[model samples]
Target: MKKILILMLMAASFAAHADSFVKGADVGWLPQMEATGYKFRNAQGKEEDCLQILKDLGINTIRLRTWVNPSDDSASGHNSKDETVAMAVRAQKMGMRVMLNFHYSDSWADPQQQRKPAAWANHDFPQLLKDVYSYTYDVMQAMKQAGVTPEWVQVGNETRTGMIYPEGHTDNWPQLAQLINQGYDAIKAVSPASKVVLHLDRGHDNKWFRTWFDNAKAHGARYDVIGLSYYPYWLDGRPDYTLSINDLAANMNDMAARYGKEVMVVEVGGEDSQPQNTYDMLMAVQQKVRAVPDHKGLGVIYWEPQGARSWSHYELSAWGADGRPTKAMEAFRAR
Candidate 1:
């Protein structure tokens, strides 16, 4: 009896010292805006209503994407700068920390497409970097002015390729690092305490991360956190939850140790298109990550949970269409 009691006490003690990590969600640009009755979703839900749902699910952070000019029909009408700021304010009022994602384009900026902003279409390399810095600073200052200082800032979204288009490609990490540093400097200039995250995809590819981060470090790019995007369906042939989770935890630890910075699974989600499997995979990943040494595991943020609302113009698959607790959410909480 004494032996069992002592073992239980030890377990409790270890749990207390383990790093407290955040479980977050990105509301996606359009749906969130529509939820505010800004554009679509005529009878929009109140911001507090959505936040209350998240809070009930134990989510602590909110990520909002900002576009330069979303009014152009040729581009996907995502949240404009003002819309993003409004969301940030609402999130702050709900007691959620905000993560600002700079798309740096009038539309979606991802590995496949990174269309440059209209005003920056003709700017040269030096001028482009200047614009990046100024835009970043101005956004940060605006958020601060609204009393919604972002807790974290992503310089660019899914920048496995790069942002600002032709000049900021990943292969040219040297020049890209300089542009990223300019943004980092601007963030620090406005909010010295805010953490600047350099985001990338291909989280399972350890070699890709090693090479990319090593180059960024060598180029003296300053950033406070390392962010990764892990989508099992897209990367791995099928949803192999266990293997992907183990790989992600190991990769996160390896990168944190190698780069000497806290690592965040900034973006992670299973295909809502395959709800059951997606939930299972996400849960598996969360459980595996929880077992990793506390110091190395930052937290996991679901890319979008309420995507089924049909507000997003991207036509991506959503897991919440059935109005059920996704396996991913169940698995995440289980961890």
Candidate 2:
């Protein structure tokens, strides 16, 4: 009995050590932009040094989003694939792991919008699947050539409504699974060590998670991680932050246990323009995430701190107008 107790104690210590090493942030584009003078510092003189600042705050990973083609004119606009690979390379140089989020479109791809890339619009469903596979493979190859192999690859972003939509809807699990599998296969072909993540919105809804994942499994969609997007104001109408965080963490733990996969709060953040209440909620959520078991919970990622009203020309701001680290960022550190 004494020997068994000793073994258990050692196992517990190992688990704690593992958990302590996994804190991360999704600040991929921020750092690269910091070099270009897109500031995010506050009045305290905390400069918008994304990578260095995140490293100082215990962040070990970075996530970047990639789009197929980002401009309607095609003459001058952001080249998402190139920019993402550049960011990944820089992150790796900073000793942080990279997770590439493929939007599979020219612009933003989310639950409400899954606009097909112009090149793939003419293709039928089967042809589109092939295009997905080929595009994924080509991108992986390009990243590898650039010496920036990602640690994780997301087939699509916030795909609860399904990606490349009209055909890849949630109800068409079998076809969607095949498309996802193609992406997985492409990633494995280059970086076999990389993990494949299946991302979805609606982190607070446990029933939605269960149904979605169960259906994916039934369709033979193999994935290494379950990614969730949690936005308090949008997801929960009342905006009760504490309850929402607790609920999300609990649901994540439950889903991990059921699916035998690690959980990632892949996209999570509140409007920086909001008061201390929003910050408090974010911190509470981080605390709850940290308390989860190491084998189940991986980490939480803050979506886009620089995209806030203070820094960008884009309206519908998510960040504050001051270009400083909001209460939400401090909450991210759980300090």
Candidate 3:
């Protein structure tokens, strides 16, 4: 009887997640934005909850990032674990699934800068690993207590050269792997159902991903999903050049075939002024991702769909000068 019940529960879990296409938005700074008196509006210019605005446009998932110990002002420091929980609770209440992104830094932890948290600045390799695990576990526990079960958890955000600074740089692949695995272990221990995502900055550069993942895999790092950040405008005029929709699709399909793991464009955005172009680009991204074999492409997430009203000062968001979502949001329903 016990075995039968266990199997039934497992089946139920699978059923709940089967064939899910995550139309997600990353509002990691929403708390900060709201605290600073930012308000959102719908097409009618009527005030609306930011989450409601996204849901109305077909977004089903919320991706939020947490900071270890942000020392910025109250609004800026809202990325803390406790603060993340509060935001996640709100998103969950709207029937939205959560994707907890751990930046692993006090401020921004991205490819260009992965500074060691001030508290761990002097820690040795082993101690740093422990800190990573502890921070991840504590945050997951907090979210659980808040009744927010993250559907996906990112170990590190835009970890192109790895996280936690020089110690985990590309040359120190082993150290990076250890840090990532520690985070992965903590999330699985606390929320086994949550998928772990290893994120990087470039969605079109398959070679960069191959080399990074190969190194991580060699060092025993494990993850269930590969998260990519694609910002075409930023890539323009770069040596490698930006990808068209077809290029993005090819790269994503290749990654799926090569790694055999599900993937998501965990971060994507374009110039807010070019809403029509933004809509077309995102529409292409969606269709291409869905074309991956066996549906390995989970979905694309707009980094900050709440830019109107000048929240966060992001110029690439899908919001308009009128404090309403632009045509860029139509990509989700473009099919």
Candidate 4:
């Protein structure tokens, strides 16, 4: 009886030290994977679902991207509202937290492009805000009906400038804040506990984040979390970042102190050439996040570690050519 009690106490202590850190992955390609003849193999070389493989890696959260009525065969079309709910239900069944990413576009939305959905292309800024609010509310309502409440809802994906292009850009900060507030309010009305994230790429630049958030705060934009995208391999190529990994960690710390909001690496990837290097990058990012004052740095997420050379044509996947995840994924192991 004494031994059992000791073991129970140890488990509880470990849980308390861990503090609900999120090790997440964005597998937006899951449905399309099912459509193809591909199979994700586990460490034991047995055919397994991609998500199950991720769960085995100790990934506690799943992030899925959704589009605004994309046409069939488009990248965004594969991840419709039904697909988002399906993905969320699968993650929830595995006892994993979920993050819903609303791209607010019919196609890919990123720092380089933020096209207004064709259906709303003609709408003025005021009408656009209403559309954004309705779309966000509707998605949350559907997820709730499916018995899945997202732990986080991203208002937009990689919005370095502003969303909806010509209509709403950095030049017009007030309109941008209004549009973001609409989405923030919608998510709150549906799932009060679900934290809203304002996402941007470039995880290493402190100056850009300060400027952006300063503008956001002044214009009445509110959010619970700050989402960053860090691609170590792609960092040097971008003139704006040009930062080393150490710089990335410093940026995270500065964000926590400056914004007083939780920070997360919503998207990250490493080169597959050296699994150890990938592992190091993951650990490096995780350490910076966990080191944030007051535990506001949430965690790091691998963007598409399973996509590989499959349908996504993404080369940064941690999976080996032999159909198994490399040892790098073991970086997710609690230290």
The prediction achieving the highest TM-score against the true structure is 4
| Pairs that clash in candidate 1 | 272-319, 279-327, 279-328
Question: What lDDT does each candidate get?
Answer: 0.74, 0.74, 0.85, 0.85
Clashing pairs for model 2 are 40-323, 41-324, 69-106, 308-319, 310-321
Cα-based lDDT at residue 166, candidate 1: 90
Q: Give the TM-score of candidate 4.
A: 0.93
**244-329 in candidate 2: lDDT tens per residue?**
77678888888888888888888776655574776676666666665667556677776755465544443322355666555555
Work out the TM-score per prediction.
Answer: 0.85, 0.86, 0.91, 0.93
Please, what's the RMSD in Å of model 2?
A: 3.6
Model 3: per-residue Cα lDDT over 112-150, one tens digit each: 789888999999999998999999999999998888899
How many residue pairs clash in each candidate at the backbone level?
A: 3, 5, 0, 0
Task: Give the alpha carbon lDDT tens digit for every residue of 160-210 in model 4.
Answer: 898878766878998999999999999999999999999888878778888
What lDDT tens digits, residue by residue, belong to model 1 across residues 1-335?
A: 99999999988876764425667788755354444553211112323355556655667788888888787442256578788888888888888889999889988889899888999999999999999999999999999899988888989888877778799987787788888988999999999999999888978888878888888888888998888888776765745655566677778788877888877888887666566777676666666555555455667788766565444433223334433334445555554
Off by over 4 Å in 1: 1-20, 30-48, 72-75, 291-294, 309-319, 322-327
> Which has the better TM-score: candidate 1, or candidate 3?
3
Q: Compute the lDDT of residue 202 as modeled in candidate 4.
A: 81
